[model samples]
Target: MRFPCPDLDPPYYAVIFTSRRTPGDGGYDAMGERMEALAREQPGYLGIESVRAADGHGITVSYWRDLESIRAWRQHEEHRAAQARGRADWYEAYEVRVCRVEREHGFDRQRA
Candidate 1:
């Protein structure tokens, strides 16, 4: 998706998901879109950014209002199912990192 969500305001949480795909799409693209849509419907979901390289490595960092929000999203039934499918069908390997964003700053020349 986009590189990053704008003006996240700090004191939030980010779930960083890094992975390597197995091979082909194998329905992963559709499910990924579905999960993203579902995440947007969650109570504390801020936004999500994702990208992939030609070598099959990818990263998706999802912003949330708090740890509780992140936990809820993780245990969401559909999201849990997607995680299962990712392990069984889509991803060769993956890692998830959760961090508190205490502060943030950036530049956007395009906005200037």
Candidate 2:
């Protein structure tokens, strides 16, 4: 399901994390849920959406108010540990991109 987010104006930040997973779960699912819960408790957090394919390819996009919030999340102790675990066992490969969202437009049939 597409996660709903509050309507935010221009100039926010988005972190797009794309990854290819390893063979099995390796505790990744639990850790991911924990991390998402933690992120929601943090300052400047906006929203997030995630999807995974049967082939173990996935993408998670998280929105933030600013870069400093992203840095803080990166430095969080539990998140650091999860990162280490991901590097060692969970993900085969991953890429992270941070972008400034200058503009956005979408259509929702329900809204219409």
Candidate 3:
């Protein structure tokens, strides 16, 4: 798998998002792509990884530099709009959890 961000050390933050997608797109795909692009421009965005199962359950983990960055992203007008759209149309159910990374370890086989 390709990693979105490389060389990230400890003491970062991650927003863990898990959700069940609704039956139809309802503009979700467009908005999701837009959000990814917009997020990449944000001040503290590190990277994001996301995947959806054939059954429609999905998980997205977004890395950030700090809690302040997360808060700013949550309060961003466009992001807020997306949240409303998610509640009103796109998701069957969803949950978000934020956690701090105190330590991490990984190796890339391709690099090896």
The per-candidate count of clashes, in order, stands at 0, 0, 0
**Mind giving the per-residue lDDT tens digits that candidate 1 earns over 1-112?**
5786878978999999999999899999999989989999999999989999989999999999999999999999999999999999999999999999999988899987
Task: List residue ranges in candidate 2 displaced over 4 A.
Answer: 1-4
Tens digits of per-residue lDDT, candidate 2, 1-112, equal 3466667787899999999999988788889899999999999999998999999999999999999999999999999999999999999999999999999988778898
**After superposition, which runs of candidate 1 have C-alpha atoms over 4 Å from their true positions?**
none
Predictions ranked by TM-score, top down?
1, 2, 3
lDDT of 1: 0.93
Looking at model 2, residue 41 earns an lDDT score of 99
- Winner by TM-score between candidate 2 and candidate 1: 1
TM-scores for the candidates: 0.97, 0.94, 0.93
lDDT for each residue of candidate 3 in 13-109, tens digit (9 for 90 to 100):
9999999998988798899999999999999999998888888899999999999999999999999999999999999999999999999887888
How well does candidate 1 score on lDDT at residue 43? Answer: 96
Residue 39 of model 1 has an lDDT of 98
Prediction 1 TM-score vs. true: 0.97
- Cα lDDT computed for each candidate against the true fold: 0.93, 0.92, 0.91
**1 versus 2: better lDDT goes to:** 1
